[model samples]
Target: MIRKSFYMLWGTQTVSNIADIVYTLSLVTLVFTQSGSLLTTIFIPLFRMLSKMISGLVAPLIMSRLRLTSILMGSQLGQFVIFTGLIFYLWLSPEVSYPIIFLAVFGMSFLDGWTDPARNALIPRLAEDEGLMKANGLMSVSDQVVKCSGWALSGVIVAVIGAIPTMWIASVSYFLAMFFTAFIRDPYAAAGVQAADKVSSAASGAGDVARKPSYGEQLSEGWKILATNRRIRTLAIVDNIDTLGGAAWLGAFILAFVVEVLHQDASWWGFMNTVFFIGSIAGGVFIVARVKKLQKNAYLWMLFSLLAYVIITFFFAFNNVPMLALILFAVSGLPVQIAGIIRRTLIQQNLTPAETPSAMSALSVLSNFTFAIAMLLLSWIADRYGMRDMYVVAGVMTTAAVVIGFVYRSAFREESSPAYASEENVAVNKA
Candidate 1:
């Protein structure tokens, strides 16, 4: 039963991810063709990032009051409705307005913020501790598969069927995602309802003295937990630092490297991306096959993964041969994929089910903010210095951060928590 539920959730998420890629590609193509304005085309990503930031900030409060299943299903339904409306509007008017496009993107991205955290939190509830690593590895594999296939296919689909028709198809994907999400069994739903009933009973008995937490207080709780917990705090800092350096892999920097250093055209850029995704898929498969062995020393695996990424990236920066560069790029993807799987599994293992939602949301907020700032700073540095120089800097900084993380490895030592233990026992019994 547990395995069945997990597969259902995974399938739903896979469909949704593919839809997202197609939708974004179609929208970008439409905007650039109609407006012929680079600024308008760029604003799409900016709007998405901003909307995600806002939604991440508020997700904890919403999750606290609602079932994860409801949040997941509602988010998918919301996207379906938005895309359906947009398709109808285009069918009627057929004029692509920048403001309207931005608004649509904002709505879709805002809802996406809730979907990710909710899904991450739900995984622990559905899988036992012994199986958590395998589950996470499977998720990573699915994500990489979707990214490679969706990105590669979206361009062709848009060109052949047109962006408007592609949007309609994406809406159907969302509808299917919503339909599948409805079947997921959230074990926490009963407990949450009971807790809410107890709260209401206490409130009535106490005659107005028992007040629910305000939105501001609820919002701050996630951040407070992250700040006060030594293990969580240390992990958050390390991950953010890593993300700061990893932002150098953005398209602008990659394009610069290809054009300036490799003396290659846009086709090489696409090929390099394909190679990286293929490498990521290979890494995911390797981790999934070794999930049991890796779970015993997840932190050590994380450290090794980081070291491997740093070494490969350093070499990649200096290599000029196009074929060698392609191989290096493909090899560089493995460590990051392994590191991501271990990190996510470790986080889920450390936090209690009740705390997982807020903790993941806080982490999401930090990641998005740090990535945005890093992209801006790195883009400026790349503009002044060469892209190769920026890659070297990124590799060095990431290595330094990983070394610092190892120095504080004691913080990651697992401590017995009754909440987590109880949740684990429940999951094991269910399995």
Candidate 2:
């Protein structure tokens, strides 16, 4: 079951990333061909935010309906259709308006947001408790590796042919992903006895006899659990801080640097993203071994990583040298690696299976809110105050998170009972 889950997830991740990378490059080319305004670039992130906001509201509902394997395979099939339709519309029909393309792509982005949480929530069902963190780290590492590799590969595809062929590669990747996902035997029995009972018996494809958990009731219960769960609630805040700090480096501030600092061609943008992603992949591997360590002292590592990121942000803002900033960005990339591993594993550990999807949605919404607001606020500060000085604001706010952490330390150390600690994690696997 574990082996099957790993292969299945790898397939989905690789295809999804290929689809993303190709779509991104294609859209940039299309926008340039149509209207070359710098502002048009904002459409990529705008659709992204629309997707996140929508997921905050709807992802749980969508997650609840389909079994994890179906949800994953279905997502790929959806991508294949969406990417194919966009290619035909843009390259095939010149008369179609760009807004039509944007709307179609935006709807696709909204659907794409469903993939992450649903996939993450499915891991615990595949691996045991001790293995959970490793599972998450492996997935995170694979995502970065695939995303970066896809970005590198897309350039060759784009150069050899054009955006249209590149998108075709992406479209095909999604379909191949669907093929791979067909191998995953379902691992999850639904949560709560009442809601899960209605699901087809093992005579059907589902792994075990599952109790049907009420979607509405399970979701509501998750909120109640979250309300009482200080560890999760506190870590969620720390996760937001981590995202906000990284956003300074990834979002507006990075853009500000290219225009104001590097003074290089805008084409380097994707390449720069690839560089940090490579760093993140490197960090991801080291984190797999450390994930269990994090499980032991989850709060401390969480706060420690946040502190590292905060300090890295301060360095990023004032540094005059591009090389120095890039190095710091690599280091800044570490927290994102560790915190993400810790956060997802902890969420899964803490939440009941039924509540997992809604809990993820709730966290996704809050984290996305902080990221968007930070991006906007940082942009405003760079415009009005001074680009370098915003680091001071970032530093101050980030430092405050430590104080919050100090007060919340007890909650973060909540002990896991024996039942959740399964033998699969501790047992030696030959793979």
Candidate 3:
């Protein structure tokens, strides 16, 4: 069985995920309703992403000073307080400025940015090494569940009761998430985490005192670690490129593909989305059930999964039959799900427990930044060149990642040594 703390973490994440969807939908509806400006509604997500990128850039500093559980709880509490105030203002105000709502969205997302890195860091503390894949699989499944069910449910709740009441429900969800976060324990304390810093400082001498690192050092710590570690550096590059390529699957791009390529109506777009999500959930289940066999060859599993993406994506790029397109899309999620769960497990396994937050934070920054670029760049490609060219460009990017993965295949060996301190790992971590 997974530990109680993992369950607690899962519960906290699940509620927060639900709250996020509900809150975003309500905010978007309210902004468009009140302002009647599409640009105003667009700014809500733009501001949220910008704030998260900023938060991610500074996350290492906050993480360096606090325990993972403390960071998680504090972030959740901060978001809850800000969101509650925003909801109250929305309820009372006859006329609210766009900036007011954007500010609240920014504040909440900034707090939320710290949650993922902290949570990923904490999972290693809660789960045993052997069960790490299972733990990650469970987390992935919950995320997919929230995406599938939470969106549908929140949509209905908002349409029926209106945005204000929906915000109230989201507020309650955030409060519950904060309550659950309070109960999560980090079994591993600072001993492992702080040792690296202390060791580096100890070289100062017996009589001399070592100066503490500045906040700037703390902020860059993750980047330093990422640069020093060869396997992780390679993985980071691949993951970011993959994210850029994956932007083709975004809702806007998919809707366009459905309408222009498949020659289907809007209802087929929804059908394709539902099928894709269902496939993801099914894939997560398949992984959980067979994690033991899969974990052993995780590197190969990841490679094969990306290969599946290459095949499915190329087929998806040219295929005109909506029914065939649906089948390929559904099948596509299986490999994607497997790759994601294993990749996360591998990263956690490679990093020292204490190093995880910084690495995850650094990675989160790259991911969010790449996604933003990919969204705009690929959308333009789709509109200017054609959907076919857009998907082909995406496939080419994924193919580049695959080539990198193959060239560095030895670095991903399951039996390879865990990531050593930079000097040792750079020379020795290769399988």
Candidate 4:
């Protein structure tokens, strides 16, 4: 039953992610074609990121009161409505305004911020501890596969059918995703009902009313958990630091590197992204095949993965050869993918079902907010110092994050021991 639920959710998410990529591609092409302004084109991503930041700030409070399934379904429904509206507007109107496009993009992204964390939280509930690594690996593989396919197809789709038709296709994808997600059964729903009953009984017997937590209090709980919990706090810090420099991979920067540094045409930019996704897919396959072994040495693998990415990225910054840069970029994806899988698996393992939603929400907030700021900062640095210099700085920041990980390695170290599983189970049951 759990496996079935997971697969269903996974399938829906994959479709949704692919649709999102296509939608983004279509919107960007439409904006650029109409406006003929690079600044206007860039605002698409900025608005998306800003929406994520806003949604992340409020998702914890929303999740505190809503069922995870409800949040997932509602978010998808919201996207469906927005995309459907855009499709009609584009079809009828001679020209769509930039502000209207931005508004629609922001709406979709805002819902996405809630949906992403909710999906992350839902995974642990649908998979056993022993299968957590495998589940995450499968998710990573599916994600990369969708990304590769979506990106490859988006340009073709927009070219062949035009951006307006592509938006209609994306809308249909969201509609299907919403239909599928509606079928997911929340495993904790029964437990939640019983818990609520118990609280009510206790209140009645004591002749006292139990007050629901205020929205501010609910929001604070997520922060408190991150601030007080060593493992979560450490992971969040490391991830945020990594993201600070990770913006070097943004499409514009990568295109600059390919064209200016490698002296290559635009096709190579697509090729570069393809190889990275291929590397990530390979890494996912490796994890799925060696889940037990990787879980036993999860932290060690995580540290090695971070170091490998740093080394490869640093080397990648200097290489003028296109082939070598491609190889380096491909190689760099492996450790980063592995590190991400291990980090997510460990975080899920440590948190109880009750705590997962808020923790993941907080983490998403931190990650999205930091990445948005970093992109703005890094874009300036890239303009001033060159894309190669920007890549070098990213590598340096990633190395610094790895150093911090090593210094606080004990938090991750617990995952490697047998007793950690038992302790984690006890914590979950207590919650």
Q: What's each prediction's TM-score?
A: 0.92, 0.85, 0.95, 0.92
Error of 1 at 411 (Å): 2.0
Instruction: List residue ranges in candidate 2 displaced over 4 A.
Output: 1-3, 190-225, 258-275, 417-431
User: What is the lDDT for 403 in model 3?
Assistant: 88
Q: What lDDT does the true structure give each of the candidates?
A: 0.82, 0.68, 0.83, 0.83
User: Which one is best on lDDT?
Assistant: 3
Q: Write down the worst ten-residue block by lDDT for model 1.
A: 422-431
List the candidate numbers ranked by TM-score, top first.
3, 1, 4, 2
- Clashing residue pairs found in predicted model 4: none
lDDT of 3 by residue, 1-431 (tens): 35688889999999999999999998898889888989879998899899999999999888877888888888888888999999888888888878888899999999999999998887766776456778888888889989988878888888899999999988899899988988897876666555656644764656577656677777787888678776778788778888889999998899999989888899898888888888888878878898879867777888789889889999999999999999998998888898888777777767776678888999999899999999999989988999999999999999898889888876765345432223334336533
* Residues 73-104, model 4: lDDT tens digits: 99999999988988888889987778888999
Q: Write the per-residue lDDT of candidate 1 for residues 1-431, one digit (tens) a residue.
A: 14577888998999999889989999899889888989879998899999999999999889988899899999999999988888888778856666776898899899998988999988878777557777887888999999988987889999999999999879999999998998899876776555545545565675555567678866876787577666667677778888888998877788889999999998999988888988998888888789768877778889889899999888888988999999998998888899888877777776766667888899999899999999988888788888888888898878877997798787655553321334443233221
Best by TM-score: 3
Model 1, residue 428: displacement in angstroms? 22
Candidate 1: clashing pairs of residues: none
Deviation in Å, model 1, residue 13 alpha carbon:
0.5
User: Runs in model 1 with CA error above 4 Å?
Assistant: 192-211, 414-431
Off by over 4 Å in 4: 192-209, 414-431
What value does the lDDT take at residue 396 in candidate 4? 92
Any idea what lDDT model 4 has? 0.83
